[model samples]
Target: MGLRGRWYRGGTSKCWLFDSKDVALHAPTREEIPALLSAAFGAADARQLDGVGGGTSTTSKAAVIWATPDADADLDYLFAQVGIGDPTVELGSNCGNCATAIALFAVQTGIVAAEDGMTKVRMRHITSGAVLSGTVPTPGGHIPKSGLARVPGSNAAGVPVNLSFHGPWGQNTGALLPTGNAVDQLQVNGRTLRATMVDAGAPAVLIPAEEAGVDLSSMADNLSGSLPTLIAARASAGLAMGLRNPEDPPQNAVPKVGVVAPAGDYIAADGTTISADSHDVRVRMLSMLAPHPAIGLTSAVAVALAASVQSSVVADAAGQAPLPGTGAPRMLRVGTPAGVIITEIISDEKGMVSEVALHRAARHIATADIDVAQAAELSA
Candidate 1:
């Protein structure tokens, strides 16, 4: 058996996208699906040298897409984080970067017809039940490969995919502040640190870098040596969020850990200089316990939401003023190791977040097939 899928560059991430119908026909069972994906990505290999994986947490992902019959949605999208060293595929959350590419994949694959100018693909995440809309450029019933939109960390210019996350709160843990508090004091490695755990697009644990005893300038250089402490903090915060128990190990993906600080100069992963004045806040996030080369899309959304709340640690670190009581959209420029991700958050009259909008660029890379037998046998 073979599965037909397409490879796409979704913002800074890449994924193999399969139509749900095809998935149902070929790899139907959950256990079999992971085996197939692992085979395609060559999992259990840290480098993923023999597979399509780009050898990083960001690139080791997959998506199952389907056109929804529901009148309210145009398509349904499910994201998977394919583990590299472990034979696991987690479907606990959606990937914002991959969400951008899904709109293009749907239109190009004929699941949704492309309109003349901008095509709006209303997407629903199966895991979180959260809704979002992605606006894609279709000049002539086809997405053009060339555009003026430049996404940081992407080498080529591509069509700008504007994504709006609707009702982004509580997508993971059933509460915006999972612990029912804006901030919690957690004991990590015998030291108590105050942290904010928010569940907007994804559950996240935000802590001030200074409180973590990490200097922003040397944070990257020290990340490897400091991972144990950071992981302990995240694990403790996860307990507070109710994502795990005292005896259960922490969920590696959810409640992402981020060390934040006021805007500061830092060298990006590509060796480019990011001036402190270019952004409002500086953040370094970890996915699966490894430092993310860039901020994850869902994590970025959480950061934006956290910044909108005056009492949240993210707002305090960004030096954001208290949100106005009026209903207005606030903009935040988040500086990451890759570059800057700008997010606009809208709040109701009562200062409750209603929507979040962010822009990213994506490109359709290749359409190909993987032999199920080959993929399944690769590990054996």
Candidate 2:
């Protein structure tokens, strides 16, 4: 079986997208979705040399998208993390990056008509129930595919898609602080680590680098020396935050786990020097099992919102300071390996995050009919 798919460069990742209708008609039941998608992406092979999977967590992703009739939301985005070398898919988390991609794709496919100036597409994540509004610049009422906006991570030129998450607090776990504490003591790797478990954009655990006992100074070192520890921490944190059961397998996605450090000068992946004064917090996160080149957009939202809560690990380390005169409703500069991603988080009188804005870029690469073999045939 094959399905019509569109390839898109969203934020810092590449994703293949399909219509929910086609997926419902073509794909099998929920239990067999992993197998079906795996065969399609050639995930059974680690390299994915025979299929479209990019052999990495950031690239080996697909989503089922559709328009919704709900007055509040114009589109629905269901994100899927297609496994790498494993025949499985994770549907438990929301992806701000993919949501950005789907917003532009909606304009391209006429799901939402393009307005003369900046068009707004209200997107709701079916996975985690997070609501996001994306602003797609449609100059002259034309499709905004060709763009000049640039973010920290990718070099690809794409339409500037600004995503604003509305009322994202309690999105995944029904509360801003999932553990009901600004700081929690978590046990992992036979050591006690202090962490802040937040659930604004998604369920996330932010651990200080000192407690995690890993050096987040270098990107390469963060990947090689810190992956195992972070993975273990993710498993332990997930269990502690009630995101996982004692019997279920470890989740590869949420709760988004990351290691945080003070705003320190570091060399970026592109060999550029990032000054400490330029950003608030330095963060290194795991995409799946490896260090993400840049933090995920949802995770960035989590960090930014988490910083708003006093005594949270993110707040302790981030300091919530950006350069002078760089104003939004409120903002924080997150220093990633790629460079800096500024996250704008707005708070209500109650100090809960009411809205968040993340800058991203997306470009539709191509549209094609993807051929997919039976999972059983491939496994055999």
**All models: lDDT?**
0.82, 0.83
Pairs that clash in candidate 1: none
lDDT of 2 by residue, 280-301 (tens): 8899888888788898988998
Kindly list the per-residue Cα lDDT of model 1 for residues 1-380, writing each as its tens digit.
66788998888898889888788876676556666677667777888766677778889999988798565888887788888877667777678999988877777767677899888989999888899888988877775665678787677776788988999999778788888887889899998888888999888888888888766653346388668878998888888888878998676788788888888888787777788899998888888869887888899988998887667788888888756758788889988877888898888887888889998888888887766447446646
- TM-scores for all candidates: the values are 0.94, 0.95
* Predicted model with the maximum lDDT: 2
User: 265 in model 2: Cα distance from truth in Å?
Assistant: 0.7
